[model samples]
Target: MKISNETKVGALAIVGITLLILGFNFLKGNKLFSKSLVIYGTYENIEGLTASNPVIINGFQVGTVGKIEPDPDMRRIQVTFNINEDIRIPNNSIAVIAPNPLNITKVEIKLGNASDYLKNKDTINTVASEGLLDDVMKKVDPVLYQVNKSLGTLDSLISNVNSVVDQKAKRNISDLLANLNQVTASMVQSAASLQSMLAAETGSIAKTMNNVSSITGNMASNNAKISHVISNLDSATGKLAELDLQKTLNTLEGTIKELQAMTAKMNSGNGSIGLLLNDPSLYRNLASTGNKLNLLLDDIRMNPKRYLSISVFGKKKTAEPLMLPQPDTLNAPYIIVDKKNN
Candidate 1:
């Protein structure tokens, strides 16, 4: 049967309107076919939260945010959400706006331990969770500060280098490097010469070392003899220590005292040698006596009859005891004159 055009047009318009409404609600994340529960949550601030955002429970998409409006106090924002009817929310559960790994912001219901369930339109507690952007910002702020400080320091260091460096300084630096290279070369040559010198002296050094070793070996071998000699010396010293050193010292002291007394008497002209040394008159008398004795001896030699008369035939006559003239009693001088002068 052919339908009327007007009826067909009206039916088509109604169908189009219905489809448009369904599409609009679908785009808004509304599940038209399933049963759902309505709940509310209030927050002091929502970080870019809007309608059509998904409500999640245990990482599962269970509902969608419905409306965001200011509360009567105007200080708080109230968020209405619709969850699946089958998913029962505990009366004490909290709804938190968290960021997903995909960088999408959503409301996640943190399930609670209350036995009673929240009814439709019941208010759930809410908390503001830090999103990935916030965390990244928190971590990056300090690093950015350090990077800025490093850049500033680098700028200052470059300015200082530019101010201090000049052509003369550069030339001086180059000269210094050259001189350092020369010094290094000289040191290397010196080291090589030292090494060669040491190599050349190695044989003599080894001989000296061998001599030292031989001396040490000889010393080791003669250790017993050395000990014997040392023991003998020790015994001799011990014997010397055992002697009456104090008595010997006392005898020496007495001898010194006697010598000192004798010296004192000699100094005072109390002995024959002292008189001979102290008295010039005694010396003169002795010299005179010596001369007289010499004269007497000469007279006897010259004329034997003066000292002795001998009778060849009759009795020997004893001459008057050869009288030597004393220095004090003699009247004649007894000085002998040189024969040449006479």
Candidate 2:
């Protein structure tokens, strides 16, 4: 085959042009010459956002973000995108700037009324948004400042607390622990003594119970004797009840009236008791003789052998006729005097 240099050059140029067109079509999201949709939106910050980025609707890649330009009136960045026409976008749909090329990050929009709506270069008003990392950092600055102030105050308070708990407080805690240990040891030492006291008290209670038991047993054993005593007492009470001693006492009271009659006779000088009761002369004589006898006894006490002794060899004691005091012939009733003066 014969080919000219100009022909080869022209052929090579055409092939290169074809490849460039294909690459352009691919980057423009055309399926080697297929149809798509165009959606538009605006953003306040276009941080790290670029053109030819994928546009997604609810996480599905529908189009690409084409061009970004600052809107003069709103002063916000306007983003234009291209989407498929067959995928009917509602008029209230939104376009977003995603974070990755794999179409990973997404922004959602609820579809609005679409009566044959959304042609090429149609600007879809943005409804809601999520921002890039720089926007989050811009919002975080004041919060970080407040946190830093709070941390400084907290550090100062912690430092003061640490200083107060340093040395003396530690020694006080140690002393408290030592006192607790001593108390525990003393309690341990007294444990046996307390146990012995408890045991002795228990033993005393048991002994008292035993004494009560023995007393009860003795009382039980003596029940027969007690019953016999009760029977004897009953018999004696019955016998006493049957005595009828009231009749005998009434008979004796009747005899006391008769005795009172006799006593009245004696008082009136009527019988043998009345003669003896009325004998004043006899009593006077007897009293005189008793006085003389009393004197004689006094003399005998002074000279016992003159009155009581007798010489048994010749029996020399002789009876003497005593001269009695003659009250019978006395013209007057003589008042007797003590013979001790005589």
lDDT score of residue 18 within candidate 1: 98
Write out the backbone clash pairs for model 2.
36-83, 36-84, 37-83, 37-84
The candidate that achieves the highest TM-score relative to the unseen native structure: 1
Question: Candidate 1, residues 1-342: lDDT per residue as tens digits?
Answer: 999999999999999999999998899889978867999998887777889899999989999999899978889999999888889888988999886567667999999999999998889989987768788999999999999999999999999999988999999999999999999999999999999999999999999999999999999999999999999999999999999999999999999999999888888998898898898677777766677677676567656875566667876554554445445435655654333533
Q: How accurate locally, in lDDT, is each candidate? A: 0.86, 0.72
* Candidate 1, position 275, lDDT: 99
CA RMSD, predictions in order: 23.3, 30.8
Clash number for each model:
0, 4
The candidate 1 region of ten consecutive residues with least summed lDDT is 333-342
